[model samples]
Target: MTIAALQTVPQQIETAAIAQVRPKILMVDDRWENLLATEKVLKPLKADIFKAASGNEALSLVLRHRFAIVLLDVQMPEMDGFETATLMQEHESMTGVPIIFVTALSKEEKYASRAAEIGAVDYIFKPINPDILKSKVKVYLDLYVQREQIMRLNATLSQSNEELERFAYICSHDMQEPVRMMNAFAGLLAENAEEAIDEDGRRYLSFILDNARRMQKMINDILTFSRVGREEILLEPVDCEAILRETLSEFEGVIQDSGAEVTYTPLPCVETSSTLVRVLFQNLIGNALKFQNGSQPPLIAVMAEKQGRYWRFSVKDNGIGIENGFRGRIFTIFQRLHRKEDYPGTGIGLSTCRKFIRLCGGEIDFTSAPGQGSTFHFTLPSGEAARPTRSGQQAC
Candidate 1:
């Protein structure tokens, strides 16, 4: 036999086992006879059928187990189909559970519309059309199977991601010690043994110390990036305008040293982590000041415009713009376009911006041409959830 044929037996057995544990379907009616008829009609599907003689019993059964589809009767004691469906619609768990009303009611347009308003998926008459009933129920069953598969895959992927993040944290933490020692001893060598070394030897020692310092910064950034996601982030209404001003004040020395003229328009508050939002502005503004062409003072402007469900923010700078060829890797970790001698950086700033933007459920993009300056744009959750301000006063 061929190798493919040889492997068919075990595969078939596994498929059969999964199919054997059939999807659950709830059949609800005051009449025991009606419930039995549904079970008999649906027997070909080989599903795990649960019968309830009253609406109350059906609700009780639903609370205990998850059903792929619910076959409900319109006429019942204590509670009716509409009431039960309304209750199901309100429930957190049973909200997505499809319900098909097995009613003997007239086929008037209003009757169907009423059921729809109450969230009924479909309706069937007194004379159960076995073919139609099975067909409708089959769609929900297939959907349920697909949903189960997706949930399982998501769970597996989540576990793998958690493990990867843990590994990153451990590696970054372990690396800090060695980098610190190299930096400290290199400093000591430069200070105490400089008289005995030649000029080139001293130069080599300087390079070692500089690189060691850079490595230390990069390691600390990596640890922050890895650990931030694990930290408890309390999200709320954050005033974007206020955050920008506060960050600017903190970087007052850098701004004055660079002779940069920073200006911004009214910025709306957004729903996000206040701490991370400040970090994002700090990095973006810092990059603008750091990447100058040395001929003119930096002119940076920040603006926000609403775009549907998000606010599209732009940080425009008149400094050295990114070349089109290297733009693709701009957000990559530790990727720098300039040499360390010309531009001193660990290349972790923009990458951190990309990370925080995603964590807050948004995306980032930029437009730049070499030496013509660049405008970086990113989207964040709009200020719909922001705290209310006065009639004319801006919310920071």
Candidate 2:
């Protein structure tokens, strides 16, 4: 019979017997007799044996194949066991391979300390007891396999989290744009309606416009929050004063018409995204102006102070203050405390502000009592002064 045919016949016959074979073992020693003795001791376990005459050869074998246990002799010439262990740790695949020192030397304090320092998994003295060696090797091999499996599971979970975040961003962005267009057109239709339109028809049109706008705003806010979690941010020193001035300029017309008086202490410069900080301030100031009591001019004040690593900023408004119970719900999308006729908004401005603050590694909080004034507080990294303010304010 051909040699290949002969090998196949024996392999098929032994398949059932070999199913319970012990894990593979690699032996590295300068002495041929020690290698033979180790093989003989482990023979009863029916494990695959790999032999290396020197430390370098052992490392080479480890690179080419995986072993459950490595029996390394510490007294080998040239590249000693400790050096081999260090080199093994530097290899990505071999770093977790368990090393057991099998030597004839006595277990002295210094040797034990050095073994641990060199990352030996355990030390075994020569004239070894076969039973103890076999049991210890088996325990370590099982542990190594379990640890590798856990690492693989963690890697899989991390990948899944990243994919989910990406999907959320994509879905939110794709859905919100069309919703915004629908709301805009609905508003136009309501504004252009003729006198012949019935009261019920007008009411329905108003409901459609209002609810559609609310839904669109919620989707937009969700998209902003999701993007903050998924996108990498570029942080730099930002001029708070400049951003605030720009935001105020955008609201000049409303401020003029409302007879709102805005005063500010010099704001400290800080490290943040100027665009995001501007959004935060705009929302706070805009809310103050929009919610003023009837026929009363609004008084708004802005201030900042340095506190440890952060700048604490406050925007205080003498407007129709929030109720205590509704303060907590203010930063939630679509959570309006007032009716559409009482106040007009998408109910997303505060929530968007909170999201932007969190993205900049900051926090926003506020306190209010019904019929009293309210103050919104936030913080940003203290690094620089705010951008220069405009010399004077103009009416809206």
Candidate 3:
């Protein structure tokens, strides 16, 4: 597609127009001659320069305009550069704006240190070298421009991502109804026409019904993945043990029929989205049970440990483990290593688990042997180490 067409969907294109605007510069000094001299040195840079005769004027100008850099005179009447810088830091918008202290005062280490402490990017004495001043200002100016470009690009990229997710969600949701209808009709035909049709026809109808059901499941999985991306994450104190218990309960029948031995230590409460955490546990535990070693009962364990500022959780299972080469694409969506008859899944589970972990500012990975087992580990942000409500291992 053409670049223009790419930008047409989701939102209007504003980056190109905004990037063309010149970076603004604010020169603040008690004397107009100093401001004029500084402005002259910086003329080659071709920036929109604003002159302020005093700290008050500079603050006022900054409030009205976004400046790439501010050159403040250290010694100003009524309000000094240090005071102005401190005040500027208080304003959210001015947080990223860099300031340089221009002073004719003593070049004492203490003065420079004080300027540094007050958040001045640089401190310069009188008789400023035009080359050095211009070079330093140029560095900050280039950085400012690059920062703005990045911000704009990120905004554009985010808009595009949101649009794509919405489209996927809509498509997956809309496709489900037709797939369900197809499955239902195929089932009805199989039941009503079995006596009238040949064996080949019956087999063909079964294939159609099977495929329709599979397609519906795939669409449902896609919708689940899309919802993970679109949902707003609200962090709250969620009991890990409680979520795990609920997840295991959902698999109670499978655990019993497969002779799976599930156990977990006392998990702690973490600050994260409860729904997302539950999804994480559900996918991991389901994989543990589904991928059990041939004729070997599944032995699964869930455990958690407190790491600095994070809670590390591991779901270890004795199952048919991942191979060395396939590990790279193991988490890829729809990437199947086994036949549909052997392992029934859409291959969206692990990818979805990765997405959920990352959405919570966490990391997820696994280690496994080809035939032995696999252990999936992930970490979530823990605001404070939560005290476990109980101790000892619980098994089901």
Which candidate gets the maximum TM-score versus the true structure? Answer: 3
Q: All models: lDDT? A: 0.82, 0.77, 0.85
lDDT of 3 by residue, 1-396 (tens): 334655585344454325654789899899999999999999999589999998888888878888898898989999998998888777777887899999999988999999988888899999999999999999998888778877777778777767767877888988988898899989899888899989899888988988898888789888988898677888888888898999999999999999999999878787788887888898899989999755788999999887878889999998989898898788888899898888888989788888877988999999998788999999998865344444532211
TM-score of every model versus the real structure: 0.68, 0.59, 0.79
Give candidate 2 regions above 4 Å deviation.
1-54, 65-71, 94-102, 116-158, 229-232, 245-265, 279-396
lDDT score, candidate 3: 0.85
> Using lDDT as the measure, what is the rank order of every candidate, best first?
3, 1, 2
Regions of candidate 1 where Cα sits further than 4 Å from its true position: 1-22, 29-47, 53-57, 75-92, 148-167, 227-229, 232-278, 289-313, 319-347, 357-364, 378-396
The count of residue-pair clashes in candidate 1 stands at: 0
lDDT, model 1: 0.82
User: How high a TM-score does candidate 1 get?
Assistant: 0.68
lDDT of 3 at 356: 78
Q: Is candidate 2 or candidate 3 better by TM-score?
A: 3
65-153, model 2: which lDDT tens digit per residue? Answer: 77777888988899988788788778776666788987777788788788888888788787889899878876876675566555555
RMSD of 2: 12.0
Clashing pairs in 3: none
